[model samples]
Target chain A: MKLSRAVVIVSTCCLLAAAARADEAPLEGQVLVLSAASTTDAVDALRAAFVKTHPQVTVDAGFAASSALAQQIAAGAPADVYLSANERWADFLDEKGLVARRRDLLSNRLVVVVADDSKLEVKRPADLEQQGIDHVALADPTSVPAGIYARQALAELGLWQDLEAKVVSAADVRQAMQLVVSGAAEAAIVYASDAATSDRVRVAVELDESLSEPIRYPVVLLNRGAERPAAVAFYDYLLSAEAADVFRRYGFLVMADDHPAADAVPVAAAQRWWGLSRDEWLALRLSFQVGLCAVVASLPVAIAAGYVLARWQSRAKWVLELVVNLPLVLPPVVTGLLLLFVFSPKGPIGGALAGTLGIEIVFTWLGAAIASAVVSFPLMVRAIRLAFQAVDPRLEMVARSLGAGRADAFFSVTLPLARSGVLAGCVLAFARSLGEFGATIMVAGNIVGETQTIPLAIFSAGNRPGFEAEVWRLASISIVLAALALVASEWLERRHATREST
Target chain B: MNRLSFRCAHRFAGGFALDAAFETDAQVTALFGPSGSGKTSILYMIAGLLRPREGAIALGKQIWLDTRRGIDTRPERRRVGFVLQDHLLFPHLSVERNLTYGLRRRRGENSAIEASRVIEVLELGDLLARYPRNLSGGEKQRVALGRSLLSGPQLLLMDEPLAALDAPLKDRVLSYLERVVEEWHVPTIYVSHNASEVRRLAERVIMLERGRVVHSGSADELLLEGYSPSGDWEA
Candidate 1:
């Protein structure tokens, strides 16, 4: 008996010693872990714990919408492990035979959120239909996972019908949260994680779990990932009790092993606002503002240059024309890089502006305006120059003969005659400004609200996406806006011509 | 003493050189020439539209152009109204606006010539609201003469203002032009190849051929002398 007892103590001590050693030794090699954006905080905590036990291992965690990660993996992205926010996306990968192994990881709650100072009150899903709430922002239910959950919840609660008119959609849960922060809407429905991240909004209502679709995230291992020992180790570590605690700590309602077996619907949800998003709306507004300001800012200079090119007799006139047209000829990226070099903080002009004038253009809306103005300046000058050329010089001479000075002749006679061309020029410049991207991104730095015009916003939003539809929507809106401007100017030109003809 | 004295020498790109000098205080002096003569060049120089290679010009001692002394005034400030062969009414402006333009720039002096009187004399009363492009050639010429008259200019320069008109229209516009200068008492330099026009419009005449003044005398004497198309005479 004494000998058996001693043997048990030695084996137990050996097991304890082995566990201690594993805690001290860092894991070896690298692992590329992809996680749903909703669980980014939880995944980061999981990575921290994994690296602590296996200090030699480096985990690179890329967080995006779960559906996006699945699509990326299907498109041959080498993801080791995917912690998705929904079973549908994981099932999508599994159907492609890209998933080597998978299990349900975590679940999340859908909550309606409102600004802290909002006078609007809502305690239940039906409360969303209350009189005080005219606009309710949510993730695009057609594609975004949170939006799908919100839609399911609203449908089950029988409030979808009444709230349809009041609903405004966003690109994702985070953007839905932004609607409340921006005060563009009275309330929003987003994932609890997104609400937890923002301090400006508070949860107005917690959706009933039974009414919504089961919000379970399934973690999957891509086929390639299963072969990597470190990837498999990281995958195992995520499923451990330690990761569960992290998920729980961050407001994820952790669930058991099974998820819904319902086939993933690849079909996007029914159209809302013809598939417009808050990001797209903001982008449109920002684009027009930038284009208009750019045109207004550069018009005087463009007019002067155009007048000289049209009327002056100089050998260097062609050279001036060529110089003005250079931006149109050069690649936009080259223009962007050159502007970046000149306007960056360490650069000469940027430094002077910051130090002396307390003015900052780099990474600001003004910088975006400057970038677009430079890009579109040639178009404006060219149009106005052609207009000026078409004017009979005799008309100006007559004005001068009538005691009108140079400035007076231009303002009174020449400019009025060139009205259609001037308007056409402004439209062209404005359209160009709307599409300006490369230079604006370099100079304005694509800050979400301030410097992000439509193009830059499209790029930034496109970066964190399964948002192909959203991006295309934005692109089409911009095209429509530009087309409307063109049509309006053309109509005005025709009207002026008809009036002249009579 | 002559109220306007101008001396200018200019060379054309086609190698035609205009070396001319003349003085006139007549209420209307016509510069008579054939199509290629330098009548227009002389008028252009006095109006400061053309820079003479070397010259001096004065209107009642105002010293309009004295290149040697670097004293050249801009055309608008010179108070000289110029009417071109094309009438040169601003196509964008109505006849009324065209007339008001120079009147507006009277610069500290209220217009001495009334707009209504000038309009009526030129028969532009019917066309006041019409754009220059909308006016007939004769109507345009009427508006042009009226516009110049309203400016209250010290001198009026007309370069074939009746050249584009038919015989009857020319006679009508010529009558208006005559009345404007007589009424305003403005020193006028009228350019034309038509000897009859010179005789009817001018108190004195200077005939030019091949960029040189071939004759100058009273309108009847110059017309009687005739513009020698072959440049046979000297000033």
Candidate 2:
């Protein structure tokens, strides 16, 4: 079905090009091509080579996550061409007639990767089924193309049904690789291109190419009526022997050059908030709940740590502060692994709770919240610490003089004075939780509508060929959410300030 | 009648020591001294806010502090009122709330001063609902006085209470103090550098210099005519 769609797309692109060439000659002028950061290296090399050969035209390239780039395009941003990591996005533009023509540039393979120095042996793809080796990282299959391929591969192997309890879905293929490379997970199924970017990890088993749809990278010229000659030229240059060699070096499988279909999305597709499907939205809602829970749960601890670090006269205060902020410095995957090591069923806390209290955290939403909280905890403490420090000690002293005891003084004076900082910390925690990827994936095992957040949704969306639009949609929503959170924090801080003064 | 007596010895580093011993049966006894003369320190020790190395403080038949037995009490349990040099009024609470705090904490006590009587005694009726930020220095000090009185303390310790106010404002508060001491007859140890206050308010004067008591006598005798450097009773 996908092959037939590609054929139709290629024929449509060819027809469009022929008609354009007959009417207005070949496109000409300076070109701007925006692409996903994953393709940054490939696109950069291609741009340099293209610009060197054609001195009259210059190619200005912009790189971001595919969803971000696609949103910029849909917003009618000044971009001549957009080359995405998957065909779904290009197909979206084609359906909207936003693209003059779409073309399949390259193909990618999905494979299971592990840390090069990993102790667990995975001689066969089915070895991922081992029970003790619980953590299996993958991109969210709904939104990210890599995640889709990984899920498809899992389903094909009949592993998806049994592996549901073990699967940890990262926000993106990069994060999935991080999970395995950091020893947080036993294995991660990612694109070969992604695995090539890291030295710490190596591909363990190549996913059966026939099991899942081919990972096709498609390029679309977005300026249809006012065709960007430079953009079209850059697109053509991608098909040249030189650019193809660079793409090949990046582990992309070169496909026969072909035009793209005019109508890319079939009927009966679910509408999304950016790239997230209904299930992914449920994941997002769950992510929000988890993030909020993490922040709220950690708030008292953060505030206490902030107070002690800010005001306590103990000799060990500095050491405590450093310990509190350690999560900020360590990589998130490391934090996740640390959490897993301590919270897994056999881990101390895990064993104690499960054995004594029967409260299991492994592969649970609560576990995911804990992972996100650990990573985001430092942010809350830092923010709250600053807030606590800014409080005038005189206020507490005055409360004491007015017959209030220490705790009463704190509640009456110190807490109110630091309200803005607390609010700012909570906002930061919320935003960080919404976007949390690595730690959450490791602890929660991306069960759809269970632990996945907006970032995970976008990451999963990026894996499918035709899900680029969905990824872009999710990306747009995430950006909006993050922006809204920041603005709200600033507003809250100002409001608190005014109230305190009044 | 409440009578407070302190025979206290406190040591500072490098051999400096504050050796003070005095007894006050009067309604107001002034500890007159310049800054760093251990006047505030004595008040703090008397209020049980500070622990002196060697001291004995007795209020009437009650032995509040005794170095020999090591029976010191925490500030909250001590029945003493302390007004600091600056009015340390609770900024968040209204004047009435601040005045009522200690009273409420000592809940179910029959001897506790009624909140209404405190408001009337300190002339804090109009300022009751107002927050500390809205109150002037004189007003705050009066409220502080009211709050202290409401706690039903045996003795009141005023540590340079008018130091932060200007002369005119100080006079206004000092006049109010005279009225309160005369009408309520609250036993008091008032610390101040102004000699005239010693003459007008305190019948007995405890003079301190460099953390040591130099003299103790009637206020009139210390500020005696021809005894001053100018040999004149200016006031």
Please report the candidate that would top TM-score against the real structure.
Answer: 1
Clashes counted in candidate 1 amount to 4
Instruction: Give the per-residue Cα lDDT of candidate 2 at A240.
Output: 81
lDDT of 1 by residue, B1-235 (tens): 3489978888877898988888888989988777778888888788777888989999886888898999989888888888888877776667788888888888775557888888777677788787877878888787778788888887889998887888888788878877876677878899977767777788998878888887788987666654443232332
Question: TM-score, each model?
Answer: 0.63, 0.60
Cα-based RMSD of the predictions, in order?
A: 21.7, 20.2
* Residues A1-502, model 2: lDDT tens digits: 3323533554465456335423542236556676754564567567778868787765656554465456545543346777787877677666766787777878877888888887778877889887658899887667666677788888988888888788897755666776776678888888777666556677788877898877788877776423665666677777787777777666677788343212211122343434445655676666666766777678779889888888887787879988888988888878877777787766789779878976657555677779878888898888888888877675565444444677876876687668777878888888888888877655554444444567766665554323546777777778888999899878866766665342
Error of 2 at A469 (Å): 3.2
Best by DockQ: 1
DockQ of each: 0.33, 0.11
| Native-referenced Cα lDDT, model 1 | 0.75
